[model samples]
Target chain A: MHYWRDGILALPTTSHYLQLVILWSIPINFLTKSYEFMLSAKKIIKCLDDHWPVLETLVGRSTLGSFSFQDVQALIQRHSPGFSSEQVFREAQRLLHHEVLIPLAKSSQLELNRAVLEFIQFLTQEHQLGTVGDIQSRIEDLDRLRGKLKAAADTKDVSEMRRFIRLMDERVREVVKHFRKNESAIMHLVEKAKADDTKLSLAKRYSAVMEAFDEYIEPVLQMIDINAPFQHSMQALEHQLSELILNIEQTGFLQSEKEPLVQLRTRLLDMNQIGREALIRSTDVLMPLREELRKNTLISRNASALLAHLRKKGLEPTLEQLVPKFSSDHQKFSLGSANQITSYMAELVDFQDEAYQMPEQVDPGDNANIRVPDLAEVLKSARVQKANTDLSKWLAKSYPQLPVDELLFLYQELSRAPTLKLQHLEQYSTLEVNGYRLTLHPFVPTATSGT
Target chain B: MQIELEQLTQLAEIHKKLSTGYHVSEQDFALWQELDTNEEAYSALFTALGNQLKRDSRGYFHFDVDDATVNMGKISRLFALTTYALVEFFADQGQDPLRALFEVEISHEILASILQQQYHLFEQLEVFSATDLKREVMNRMLRYGFAKAQGEHFKLLSPVYRYLDALMAVDQLAEFPGESSTSSFTSNQEQADV
Candidate 1:
């Protein structure tokens, strides 16, 4: 009893105790929350805790996120030195239940949750980018609140007005906070992209750019009417507030309404201006991304087309004419640099030699022994042959009983003969040319010329 | 019915994009908002030029295709085939084609993998290399504003709804009745512009 009494007496006053409680509460609250999260996520955490060495192995591995259960067990055993299969199964089940680890559908693979992986990825990032989605809902919320405020004003409910005012103020503050945070995020993304030059592949690097455009910029732009849905919404709120002020002045009731209405109006104006600037800032950030996309896409498209040319005409012809090359690999050039002309000089002599290789010098002596027939002599011989006998008779004599292919070849040759003025006679004769039935055509007299 | 053509301030820009079949989206907010504000004048001006103003339910404006670009050669068929094949590929991979198209970073490797499955469909396109296919076909789609390229990746844009319609058509063919083919989402999504 004496000791208890002394303990109480030694304790500080009620206020001092309260101060101490307040002083320690922050860290205590944080610790408790962390503990709660750790507890909830314990199944996964316990698995890691039991096999703490596995973390080092995982961190060491470059390729991550997908591994078989057996592979996981191997990693676990290698790290923990005496890990059992039973323990592996138990811990895996626990992690799976907590959703800290996911078993890939239709496979024996497991992966960490996207959030955890992204957190690790964020750590690797020198510059970080953020997306703004929450604020869009905040703006929508403010619009909804304005409706309630208008209704409350009509009813002349003091409590309702106060509640609506407080709620609206909170919403506006949230929106402003969102705007600031998202602006910081954009700055981070841009800096990260700059820092990450060449470290990431082209696709991996521009993935963030695509995400910014598709996920953030496009959607936000869709939300804002600038002059329509938003403008109308602003005008309606302003009109309602002004009329409320007028009513308050008329009835001399709800004196508190004046300040809140003015504050709301000011906030609305700020939001209107902020929305535009937010979009402008987005555009400023995206301008570089956009330029990079355009340049890379342009270079890829042109290279593809040129490669197709290379495939068709072979390398030499394609290489002969110098195409414009983008030195995109060297420096991270802005959009302005895209149009900036750069000069490149290739050795024209080498390309010229390739393009116009001199025709092989055929020694005139190589073909001297081979007598080439004159065009007039060839024509006269064909005239003499045709005058002597028609095509079928000549075919029967010179190339009798030839195969179908040779017969067709002779037919083609006879058709092109200069002096063979042949005409198709319907069922004139059935001749067996090379064991194939032939519909022979009789000669037609041309200007009393006999053939 | 005659009015001064210059009354439509964005006439030249509108005409150029419309001629190329580029959908004028509200996301192109500045010019589109201007167009929206002056809808009456712009419509009239377009009508005077013998082009009908078309408003897509998906927050875009364009000229109705009275003049078929008439360039529907093997290349066009290849483009149409590739679009359909990709939608099928994503659907097979247990992904919603529409969402996947916008979300995924479509690199050369991915393109090659998907194309290998639809080899028969693209036999005539002569898409021997993934790079060539991207440059010749996918890049052309970019030119028509069906998608935008970021590095080697392409994120599809809203105008891809036109392709979505193509995809739906292919599904309707496969399903035949077109009743089971219709999801409640199709009608719901057709509501209005952003």
Candidate 2:
């Protein structure tokens, strides 16, 4: 009896050592054979622990709680070496029968949880983020990176591709985090920008206006020299200023009296003054200066007719030669340069003759009878004359049906007597002879009445 | 089709009387119905008769007959002439002595009665229906040696008045038959006949 009691005591010690051996062997087997398998098993166990309730809820039963033990055993076995698929299956059956393994429905939930946990771990470890705060901070870091990427894209800088790739990775992590929490708001923001046609158009217009101003107007303004810095800037912005003025006029943005454009105009005029000064300063020093002088002489002419008319009207008649003073004060002329002035006047007369020379008058007698050609013919001739010879030939070939006469008349009216009134055509009434009225052509009637 | 035509004729007569600003009587409508079977014929007769009966330019009938400006007396005279001319034209065309003479003579009596009843009703009224009537009357008028309707209105051939006067004289002679009452009536009747 004493011996049996001692053996029992020794058996407990051996059992303890055997359990320790199994525990030690497990880790060694995992480390030596399939570290990845061991990691997967731990991951699955952690997933189950985290999502136990979720799995149960998805399974739609409380039965999954009893299966938790079986889940742990299967996961442990799954990590062990020398375990056949049959052995794993038998273990799963035992747990399932005992309600230790969750239902198939709960298993699916567990698998999804495992995937999410893996993704989360990947994101945290790979991107160097530990929490939501870390994700937020990373996103802030990405802003500058994203701007650089955009600039690189704009400049087509191939050297920045690696930096862009790093940025893309970080951006993916940030986007995933954002999607998890504020998916709806982010979606709405994207959709709103996409759907709003007006906003899109406005954005385009704003960009286009900016580009146009930069290209066309900026260079012109920069070339001009101005004393005032503010004026120089304004001169540079002339094109934009003009555009603003046009917009104000066309849209009546100011005329509604809500937003007055006078302030804008005043600003523009100030700008113009600066621009003019700058232009003057920037003008080439070697450029020739122009000097013009004029002298006034009053002479009495045949005004007796006008004096008589004024006397008849009981009014005093006074004649005065009023020569307005020059508005610009750049220079002035003094008296006593009569000889030089006379020579200048003579030159001025010669210049005037050259500049204001009249064309020789056509002799009407040579063309007078002119057979009083058909108005239609006259109009056709006018059209032909107005059209370039090449264009006229092309038009004649292309539009044979066009009323040449009418076109000529239109051309003549447009060129010679633009202000001709329709009332001129109404002067002739239908002529009655022997109780019969004749319908004369419009031109004929006008011509006859005038005659 | 016949029923529609009859309805149309009635409507036209109603339109005509309404156009004249006159309250048509049942007897007058019956007389108008008896006068012509054809709707087009009736319109012509009615239009012509209206022109004859309403002498003043103030009423709807004067407006209908004289689209342009006309003095009341001239309208009255034109109305008289129109009625007489229509009756004569129809009589000559139909060659129905009784109906023709009857139409002519009745138009004169109708005028006299209408004038006696109220002359002021035929003055200063505008004719809004001339364009429509002119379009309607031209095709038929073309057959009768009458001038085609012109300028949104109809103008009677000048010779029509003479034909109407002759018809009226014949009718008056037939109706009076030796009643030599050389009064204003006889002279007026004679003028109408002439």
Candidate 3:
């Protein structure tokens, strides 16, 4: 696993050399021609009676470079029926040491060594997603490459310029590649979080959402933050590259570098956009869950507060204090039902005591001289006074000349007294006051009472 | 408050929906969108209506008014109880209450488990079984447009942040248990009672 991880990362570092070593390792036994490699292989070969054929047959039996040791005995029996179980066990140990069959972290799983597995995956072009390094690294790499490109340009060495362009192209490809790989990895994390294969508690399920945010979202998002150093550096790199393109085109010697330079710059700028896009897409998936988490916590916290309230004041007070009354509309407490009434209760209802006798009534009237006018008389008096203005004639004369509300206000002023007997107008007319609509009416003057 | 008849035509549906406690989210697109695009118009419209339109950062729009109706108080209490009890249950399970509650669907079984873990805290809710409890909680959530029922499970909606705001207040007050939650609940609601 260590070798594979190192080897995968080291692919860019020593590709010219590994291109040859990888070709040799496939046909030949795990030979780095290093002593360690030869020793491990020799160990396996020594354990087997005829190791080459058995190893080759075992490798062939496994498809996709992944074979389960679900039945190690069955595999051995099927491959070499004549071989003893004891012999197979010893040989298997040797094969494991040689990494002919690398052990999976999970038991009952074994796969071809990383070299072979990666090779198969490569040959099949079926790469899965995982973390691609952040744009920060790419930005940092560009800073270094910019110096190199400048040097190659200053030297006027066409071959060196070509070499730098190729290298820059590869670096950008790695960035884009990682962008896609992390895309899948993040998606896988999302799926794992979303999947209900196990009844992991809600808290357990959220572990995946947190993992996506912690491991994938935050770091990448920080790298590409619009004003962050990564973005500024990326913009600087883009500018430098565009300038390089113009210089290349103007220098007129390294015409070959321009196209790739343009491509590099395009990919360079797109790197930030795509990185942002991929993360946003992933975040979009997580947002609902994220929001849910937020809301639920809020609820739980409120519940805690209420519970605290409950503890302090007891249930009745706590409940009475809760907002919006009943949490659910379902808890409607009905008034007592008639069906519950009984004859015994009816006795209580029917039994009534006589009223206490009152003292002799006396009429105390007219001595104080506080003669209160009857409401009807006062209303009639007010109406007669209000009848002084004819609202119908006033509105007909003034409505077209004034805004309706003003006209109504003027009419209201002209007929404040109720004795004027204002009525809704017969025509299609209305007035708005305090957001309420009222039908228009002309004042019909009644007889005056006091005046 | 010079609400043009045209603007009134645009806002009529929004008024009805908001009155019913439904959030006029950006997704609503038609009714409240005018208010969303025009903050001044929203303010004017709501101001004329004697209520304030509050937009939570979470994308749903609701009203914030101090009518403090009886029904609203009851709902707040229910939210208070549910949120607190849920946190307690999640804590018991060694899970982050907030994250898990949102991320995982609270099915009847899970609801049952939560209720079963501690019934007394939820006793005031007057629910008999997990199913009844889930129904009550979800119905309230649905009525308030704070959650949507997905199949047999219910997921909380964003307006639930109102409760979260409450929870934070609770936490703050809890740290100083000397000060009762009731005092802070009102102040907290004033700040973010969406």
Candidate 4:
């Protein structure tokens, strides 16, 4: 049978000989169709293996929309770089023919087959968080199947009981599968959110985490709660399956049915055990992150709000009363200590005064020969100068014996002379007089005050 | 009240640190363990010394005071502004502000940017530049047991919740003006003014 399937699958599309043989043999119809399905499945597995890079890229980018055939062809060419346009086109057609990539509705755009996409995501550990309703409905289906199984068992309808057992087994496996997938998906979300290079904004980064908590973790937690309907229903289903198994064990008439009953019972119990463990592990991984995000949001919000207040009301007023205070006795810059105080007190206590020392009088004869300049004589010298004459320069040249202060004193008196008109210069003039370089606003006579 | 002399070996050191407004946290090994082990004894000892010893559940010990000195008040205000500015700055960059504030070792470059961006706010605290900020706020934070320096970088200690508490208090005050907000501190913390 395998060789016949391979021979037909390997035949070229235009081979009329095989078609004629298949048409002539009516009994081989079902066999041929099943072979074709197996062939198609094998082709898809091979296509996925050969072009996984392209499919992975498509899965990542096409989270929402379908990709055009040309886009797939381009991805093929990009994946191999050396492939010709014809080769890329052939690869794309093979992907579609094998049903590895399927058309979306009647549109020409193609998408990864839903089943294959999920399989690949499972392999990659990049699962979308399934809703609580998904698992809840499965569990509800299991409950309904248990009732049917019990009825079939009561009547000793072995075929009906077997059918319900198969259905219940599938449902139990599905619930366990959902639990594991959702748990892994949440783990993925946390890792992506915590990754340092995630360029998403904080809100965007944590949105998936928040959604997982609200949509998956929170509702699932309620469902699997110890006293919740989920737990009770699971327990009821376990009890029913076990009762059926017990009934089969007691009745030797249905000895052939005992194995399937035992298998289904074990599966139901395993599902419950695995589901609880998965939820616990997921919650453990996620609880701290949820708490950290909550605290982070609170801190950032309060900080920003307080900052705005501080900006508007000013810092001192906004925070003055709120700031935690401490004792002020440990002054960092205090200059006085007990030792200094004691020293001051000691100095005050040792009260004594030395006898007043009178200094010896200096000789008076050194100043007697150098006569002091009379202000009247300097005034007479100034009145004879040209208009706008610099009083400082003239004084320095005429009375080089006088000290700078004494010269300045004469200049002050001459400027105030009632008999001579003089003008003060706004601009300064420098003079080397009496060992001093003085930059002063020299008193130059006004143009009108010239003699 | 009774006293246990043998159990209070870190009394003098604890008194010195707490008296100076330095929070004794887990980082202060022997002293923190001393306080943790014999809290009642230490509390009575400090109470007899005329100090209100505060044990914040957030993990630290401090000497609670009704009012701060003028200088300490100024320093505390600077701390408040710097912390708020850091939060805003980290949030703007999409980093978790609380984690960044506590976990990350803030470099001088980050400090400089925060100071530059919040120039108007820091000016009120007399923090004119990054160096001034390090000296007036960050370094002073070290002395007050609010942060620890790691070479050239620094990370805030848990007692920084004092400012975080103050941050919330400012909001509460705005919402409800008549009631005083003492969310974190053990004492009233509201003594009107320095």
Q: Per-prediction TM-score, chain A only?
A: 0.39, 0.18, 0.44, 0.55
Ranking by DockQ: 4, 3, 1, 2
lDDT per residue as tens, model 3, A338-364: 212332475678788989999987875
| Model 4 interface CAPRI class | incorrect
- Report the lDDT of model 3 for residue B45: 72
State the interface C-alpha RMSD of candidate 3. Answer: 22.0
Q: Runs in model 4 with CA error above 4 Å?
A: A1-39, A196-201, A294-451, B1-194
Candidate with more favorable, higher lDDT: 2 or 3? 3
* Model 2 bad stretches (over 4 Å): A1-135, A147-159, A162-166, A169-173, A181-451, B1-194
Query: Which window of ten consecutive residues has the lowest lDDT sum in model 3 chain A?
Result: A1-10
Per-residue alpha-carbon lDDT of candidate 4 for residues A366-435, written as tens digits (9 for 90 to 100): 4456678777766766666552568778888877767778878887887787667667778889988756
Model 3 residue A240 lDDT?
81
Candidate 2 residues A1-451, lDDT tens each?
Answer: 0011121233334333443333334434332334243334454445546444433332222212223444444554645445676766664454333222334464432222223322332221211111233233444454455456546645646457345544544343333332222222111122122122232343341332232233322443443335544344434334433554575478764343213223333433533443343223212100111100111011000111122112122221111111101101111122323333554676677674336768999875523343434545544653444432222233333333435543344334533432221122333434333233433322221222222
Please give the CA lDDT of all the candidate structures.
0.53, 0.32, 0.55, 0.70
Task: Name the candidate that leads on lDDT.
Answer: 4
By DockQ, the better pick of 1 and 3 is 3
**Model 2 Cα lDDT, one tens digit per residue, B88-113:** 23322333423433233323333333
Error of 3 at B131 (Å): 41
Error of 4 at A289 (Å): 3.4
- The pairs that clash in candidate 4 are none
